[model samples]
Target chain A: MESVILQIAARHMRPLLVILSLVVLYRGHNEPGGGFIGGLMLGAAYILFAMGFGVQKTQKSIPVSPVILTGIGLLLALASGLIAVLMGHVFMTGEWTTLFSGTSFELKLGTPLLFDLGVYFTVAGMLMLVMFSIMEE
Target chain B: MLVLPILLPLFFMVVLIFTRRWLAFQQIFSLLATVILTFFSAMLLIDVQQNGIATMQVGSWIAPYGITLVADLLSAIMLVTVAFIGVVIMIYSPGFIDKGRQSAGYYPLAFGLLMGVNGAFITGDIFNLYVWYEVMLTSSFVLIALGGSAEQLRGSIKYVTINFVASIFFVAAIGILYGLTGTLNMADLAYKLRTIDHIPYINSALMLFFIAFSIKSALFPFFFWLPASYHTPPIPITALFAGTLTKVGIYTMFRFYSLFIVENLVFWKTFIIVIAGLTMTIGVLMAASQYDIRKILSFHIISQVGYMVMGLGIFTVGGIAGAIYFTIHNMLSKTNTFLAGGLVYQRSGSYDLKHLGGLYKASPLLALLFFIPAMSLAGIPPLPGFFGKFFLIKGGFEAGDYVITGVAILVGLFTLFSMVKIWNEAYWKKEPENIKHGRVSRRAIAATSLLALAVILLGLFAGPVSQITLEAANQVVFPEMYINAVLGR
Candidate 1:
């Protein structure tokens, strides 16, 4: 934890890990990766930082408490499911629209994606919360 | 519509999580949510009763292919009973739960538990049922240890460890069943089990399920964890768990028993009957030896569960209906007894019956509140418990299972003896000198009275309630109807 090399390594690896996790999250709707794995990766990034900087520092750097983060995640997931109800579809039905389209390329978004994003936040926040609590002890 | 019962609590639980810092807001919002939940479940029961079984494929997927939620008469009844109990507990909790635990996510965890219970009641997929059990168990594990006292931590450790072992058994059984049948939809599995002539190790899988559910329901040998853990929490949490948790296991047992255990009936029938009798005799005998009021009631929960399983063992329309009815009565009365015990603790500053006395004079209303549920639990006339047992005993006699029928009746007497023991020690004995008295809040009393009122109403409306349960039992007894409802055949 005190080694300069390890600290320096953690700083650079965290951003790369976070970016890779985002890529995983974005590709999950139709592929192998999903929110759960992406969130775990993101949590691992935070874990690396905590290992280098200590839990108190990590807690201070985070914008909000983990409790609020988890709550917000649940709200987002519920909101995604509820949006379908507002759209007069069944609860949690995938309501999709193409965000961008071309002859050879297209991007689509749906409530399922929002649901996945919610899971990503929740899992990451919960993991950090547990890790921080255990580490602080 | 079917999704609402599960969704509403989950939505409200999230809201409560956000509002956890606001104790007053949490309490009021929780009461409001539980009231709405009760109304929704009541409407669900009414709708099902009027229209027959309700089925919904979530996300508009086909029943067998995607997740399905079904509310037959039995599930609806369970939903309604649990929702009503939720409302009562919400009302009781504010006065009983201290500020520390209240602010520490008590309300949110409660809703989480409610959501899980609702999910378990309605889910038509076996794997989804396991998921719901996890949700329910996780919330309960937290609630049981919220205060984190030495005693509570001890209780929670045993509770969590034993329950986790039971869950492992559940998953193992699910894996085996899925490998053999290739479907996790409950009705689909039931359909296949009936169609296929031979499936190796199916009975072993059934035994695994039996072990898992019996542990959950706290039947006989697996019940040791319940009495060990139930009394450690604050009385409100204990009250909530007493009312709804084990009953979910019983409900699932009934559901699975009706759907899947038809072929091995002869062997399993004798097996269940023996276990039921032992559960009743052992639980009551242990209860009779306890001086702590909470421990006595905790043991009684085990014994009462035995009655429901006894009816299950009988395996007739009358028997299943009686089991359902007994389940409803037990949930209401068990909670009432615990809440009343909380009130006793409020006034006496103790849960030890030896340290309590003269409550009948100290507060006549408290005495009456405890008396109502106590008598009902003891199977007195003009109470729902009587009819529940009467129907079970009648079914047993009808089916010529006379030995266990006699055992049930004797257990009923033993049950009365336990209740009378509590009454004498807590309400009738002379108060010891120099005892400090605490205030019993009017709100808590009123909340408890509401439960007592429910028990009385259940007794008064036993006719109609039994009619509904009989219809529910009919649905369970005839799995073809349920299979058709889920499979759309």
Candidate 2:
């Protein structure tokens, strides 16, 4: 009975933290939160998940290594910078547009925001990698 | 292709993360990627030389709205130089990084570091520069503390703490610059700075930027963290950090000094001149007293940085050109020397000069290999370091700063003295029986030898390289060209 309770407790926490991390990441553009803080929280989620599920099960749940995540983050980040050049702007110039065709409006993304997202993945991935290596020890 | 060099590594770094079981495969792939990067960077250099400036916009975004990656001649030359060092270090890593010591995370972090460095060189915005600096810093923190020894942890904590403080200051500087100019673009900032009257706020911002950069470059006052942290890492890691990391700080300093902040001839210039003189003397004095090989090398890093910064302080084309050339020459020589020292440490299980005597007896080729780079680092003639010093001194004289020129020459002599100390203690001295040392691996020796050979080759081929540096200097001296090129004006 105790084991079952512990398992249930562990099971819900991982997804909860990951979702929370994404929330923090999403609200980063104009809010107090940003990539570095949000990604660190996300990495903490991975560690909690791994601790509860064991390294093997955690590895299966997130099959991608932290390295690949970091690389992709790098790609995303550089892509954000290059997007400016494509728009006929100087390098790293922030490009933005708002979307409101009729009455409804939505906040459109820009390179700085994209850069933030890239940083999010990079920090998250790097933190996970470091934690994983420490666990191996 | 501009994005390809950066993106390919980004791609591979991701793939390697999942393929943790194939660590060896990841290493090979990353090395191949770097080689291709070097080639692409070379092509880009040629293109920029012929075409003026190569600007690329990702996802087809128009100007001022999207980020741009500009490869001016200056940036391209840095890219090539960085790639050259990356390839050599990659080649050397496999032999030096033992399997027991290797982690699934090392290669990816290294690639990530390369991405940060390359991105920093290529980006045209100040905010983006800060972003890349974080990228590089975070990866470096991981690499330094990877093994997680007590010393490594301590060193990393100090390194991270200082750098984190510096990064905060850097972000503040960027914010101030943006608020002042209303734009984050480098070319745009240059134009705004020229048009705006000299204000007190601008001077304060300049000082803020200078303090932040000084910490990053480990200039005299902010240099304590370097010796404390640098000597804690494994030798190859130390070699990479010593060669590349601080130099990036210096690169940014050169860029900003050349483009944005040229007005303060009396205050900033005089201040830097005094700091450079003190940095050189203090650094060499520290090096002369160190018993450990790594510590000595670490001190020399500070002294050489002084030379490069002195060129910037002079604010002449020749001086700046010399700084550029000296930076490249120092990167190669320092990396090679540190890597060779690593090989020696691996053989002896220690880095102390007392414990590492008579290395020449068991490994004559390794001794010879270390000797060449050491001499180059000492600024021996017919080598890259020699020309770097020559150009710097010439620039100093041309600027009519004869007093600083005299100090630079004296620093050069001290540099030779420290190099000879290493030579005499490590190679020429007799082996104490207990410290005779075990045999070094052939592969390690081979890697060091290759780097040594490259140093000599760079020295011999200084003419063409000097031309490239000179052109880069010209670009830096004339901010209008950079602004016009970037803005398509």
Candidate 3:
């Protein structure tokens, strides 16, 4: 019964770690952490999942394969900057638009943060992909 | 222009990570992305040629506050070269890497390396340059150590250790520079450096910075790590490193020398010239004895890097231009040579020249492709390689640095000898009984032939090519245009 309880705890830990990694990735722009460290943290989280769940099950859980994840990360980062051109701004020029009916906090989204997220995904995918391939070998 | 290079690659790296299942889709997207980047880089180059400079600020932060991506002719030229080679390499990697589970990591690391390379090129902030250098270095670490062979691991540890030490020194140099100049913006530092007189600590700071760059560039005493470790990686990865990584370091060195260090001219001039001569002589002598094709090519990286540095030492406009031209030619020729070697290894299953023979009999097209770059590398006339060397030698002679010119010419001959040696052993000689040749892959041949065609194209189009080079050269020499562009005059 204790063993079952421990298994349940382990099952809950994966999503918890993923959430923690996201927090770290998001807070990186202002404080001590940034995209690179955040990505590495996320990579480690995936590694833990793979270790606990086994490579096959972990592979099943992650929607995209590691290689594709890297590609996606790359595209995200590029798109963040490319949006400037769409707005008739210079390439990589940050375009921020304040969207609210009145003077109230709503949602803030800009290309730089978007670029940071792209970096996070790329580094995370790349590190784990490398780690997994090497470990498999 | 500045942010696009870094952010574009960053975006693609992310996209690649999540979309790993679609291998064909990923390849198509990566190629498409590279084409887009090439168009962007070409536009930047043309813009720089016509308008003089382009700059972009991140987060709408003013100069000295937010990170700036500045593209003078020099940076734009490098971006174009990088995009051209990167596109070719991306196309070529598919042919050589074989479909495998490991490709998931390979594609991302490739983009990551590109991310670092472009980042290092366009960054206007000195601290940001260090960050980009780390990006490039760490990505290279993963790429080189990917297979984790006993030899590869050994090579990686050494590579990482050396580069890590260099990174420490790099950061330390930045710290010292910031302390002295009170600014991390390169143009600001240049402005500050000029106003200060005989500053006792400034020369020492410059020396520290020089040491950091020299170590990264593998100049003379700093070069042992390169030949020791480069051969251990798989060939395509080695090709990437040989073609791009150290050249990034050299580019950084060129950028800084023209900007802040121009204050104390005589000191750096003498120091760089001495190192250039030694680097050329030592790299060639070592290449003469190496048996492995990759190792031989690795040594030539140092030798060829010396020619570029020699141009730096001469300190004339033409001399600097020569260095710029030589750098572009060397990047293409060296990468082409390495890729060809990879194909040979793929076919014959060994890179040892002694073990390689009878390849010419089995494959004539491969031999022809190999010969084009090899002869060009030897600086034979009508090749861009020849023109690259010609401009540098002319610059050196014009500067009346006859001794340096002599060294450059001698190195050219040795480069020929080494190329001929590979030709004799790997191509012309009969394959030993143990050596077996099979039908080489069409994809491998196709990729190599494409690069071979480029070497010829660069040769035939020397006029426009050199014009681009001269424009980059002028931008490096006169950086005010860059400063003004980034920080409104």
Candidate 3: regions farther than 4 A off: A1-137, B198-200
Full ranking by DockQ: 1, 3, 2
Lowest lDDT 10-mer window, candidate 2 chain B? B57-66
lDDT of 2 at B253: 87
What's the C-alpha lDDT at position A79 in model 2?
Answer: 77
User: What's the DockQ for every one of the candidates?
Assistant: 0.73, 0.26, 0.40
Cα lDDT tens digits, model 1, B327-392, are 999999999999999999999999998788999888888999999999999999898889889989
Q: Which candidate number maximizes DockQ?
A: 1
Specify the highest-lDDT model's number. 1
Q: After superposition, how far is residue B274 of candidate 2 from its true place, in Å?
A: 1.6
User: Which stretch of 10 consecutive residues in model 1 chain B shows the poorest summed lDDT?
Assistant: B434-443
- What's the chain B TM-score of candidate 1? 0.99
lDDT of 1: 0.92
Tens digit of lDDT per residue, candidate 2, span B1-489? 677656756766766666656767866876787788889889999988888877765444543445667777778888888888778877778777766456537777777788888888888778888988987898898889887779899999999999998988898888887787778777777777887776448777777888888888989898988998999877878888887789889988878887788576688789988888888888988999998988999999999999999999887889988999999889889988899888878777788888767878877876888888888888898988999999999999999999888999998899899888888888789876777356676666766877788889889989988888888888887867887877778
Summed backbone clashes in each candidate are 0, 24, 33
